[model samples]
Target: MITRSVQTVQTNPDDIIDIRQKIAGSWQEILSQAVTNPQELLDILGLDQALLPGAVVGSQQFQLQVPHTYIARIRKGDPNDPLLRQVLPIGEEMVITPGFSFDPLGEKPKNSHRGILHKYQGRLLLMPTQLCGVNCRFCFRRHFPYEENTLNREEWLSAFDYIRSDTSVTEVILSGGDPLALNDNRLAWVVEELAKIPHLRRLRIHTRFPVVIPQRITKELLNWLTGTRLQPVMVIHCNHPDEVDADVADAMKLLRDHGVQLLNQSALLKGVNDDADVLIELSERLFSCGVMPYYLHLLDKVQGAAHFEVDEQRARQIMSGMSDQCSGYLIPRLARENAGASGKVVIAPLYSLKI
Candidate 1:
């Protein structure tokens, strides 16, 4: 049995329990819940063998940890479901490839300052927290050096200094495991520090917490988010339409109501939402909920995520189908991030065969 500290709890366990209690303290509520134990989560998704190889005994006893909010959102009895796709670890494809690496983005090399990743011009990525509600199997940053990237108060202040020193930077992006994973107090402090930098005009937060764990969107979170000096933009990650339920809708509405511009970036995963119909519905749902469909990203060529990759030709076809059905606004930019590239490259559809 592998023993570890409970600090790795995805969503705050106490907060999750409290939210469940507040909604209704019923056994049915508890039973219908998604994987609360880590082992059970692995079993439901069939990730035990993939994650921990050669470890058979006491594996069943291991409790798979799933946050109550994320659990509440999952459709029952469907293991291959799209909502389950993001969190569940399948088999390891990491061993097969040599090129697929831990830091494909070269984030460590670009770490100009503490908590700051200055890879491109005019924008900087700040790593505020090293935690996320659900660990996506295809995450490019899954192997990121979270322990090394953590910033202390002085280090955080120094990051602001780095930003202020660079006159070209206009945008500051908060990202890590997920910026929303940090408590309101910590987040607000970071925001306040960034606000001090006169050149940093826009603040962008990339997070999946609001979609996966809606309870994290407390009123206090909204207040601090909206009250900030920088123009706040929240890019939420949601791939499928089914992922958007009433609770998620409420959270999105709250963010929108508070003058936080909302956008969505989705990855094209194999079992998740590869179909044109699924993509169309997801875009429509996002538009209806006051979020602009920003970018439909091709899966990053990570090792274990080879299962999720759809080839360029098929992706282009899907994009073309989406264009014919949905309004132009609803059609997201089909793009891919080339390693060491300045910005995401938009992949245009092929016109005709030239044999």
Candidate 2:
């Protein structure tokens, strides 16, 4: 009798086309050393040892999750580093602020079926996995009970049945703790199933992998992604310009070269990207790297992340400034994800078009 581990999901090397032959096995090495423990993360970034206890408490449930690829981008010994601010499990995260609830987006009510989040019309979100490559403290779904929603083989069939019955679902969005966390074979299967629905015309993947772990953009992944029938669009998340390095630019280029449209959305974190100058730099850097600015999101008021919030008035001012200097295409929509709202509630509209 033979047994297999969950990590070792058997995938055929033949199914992996062109590029996979050249660079076959390297992600595992990166994954093995990904920052999971509190002390290792602090030591690597040269953050103060005194901050560890608070981080441990804050990350007790969610825990510290960061990739070595991402850590290298952070300025070592700087507690106030923007990249560190995004991932560091500080003591402030332990203090639950008022009016902040667990499910900030109200996704629980919108989950129409298992493994499905039908929030907006025409497009619905699918959870291929409940895990993210790097778990940011400010994630809207930090408190999402993904264990209950994790689908098995049989549950996946029911999810398929629900989608097949509804012709209105023309687009299937792969959202998760991060959809790109799933292996190429598993993700290919999910996309293939979505393509089977005749009404589905677009496949949108909401992930942070290309920013945090550029290595994730391998030939095998692209092969599975490009092989799909559904038109592919990847919405990558990047809050700061510094996150985009040469390697990241190359990864985005590969995706763009392969015909995948790339767009980016950023959270308006209080420390990370609040200033107009920082936001401007972020937009400029993103464009240079072939990624268009999609949305400059107002922070979601989740329980453990209130410290990162910037006032709506300040947020509009930043957008207004970006409007004044940058091209219209460079400016992103100022949107907020309000619970029970049909779509993203547009707080500040884009600048009026000049004919």
TM-score of each: 0.83, 0.91
For model 2, state the Cα shift of residue 7 in Å. Answer: 44
TM-score of predicted model 2?
0.91
lDDT of 2 by residue, 71-113 (tens): 9899999989999988888788878788888888888988868
lDDT of 2 at 43: 84
Residue-by-residue lDDT tens digits, candidate 1, 97-159: 665666666667787566778888899798887777666777888667688888888887788
Off by over 4 Å in 2: 1-25, 350-355
Using lDDT as the measure, the top candidate is 2
Report the Cα lDDT for residue 327, model 2.
Answer: 80
Which pairs of residues collide in candidate 1? 37-63, 37-64, 37-65, 38-63, 38-64, 38-65, 39-63, 39-64
Clashes in model 2: which pairs? none
Alpha carbon lDDT at 201, candidate 2 = 92
TM-score between model 1 and native: 0.83
Best prediction by TM-score? 2
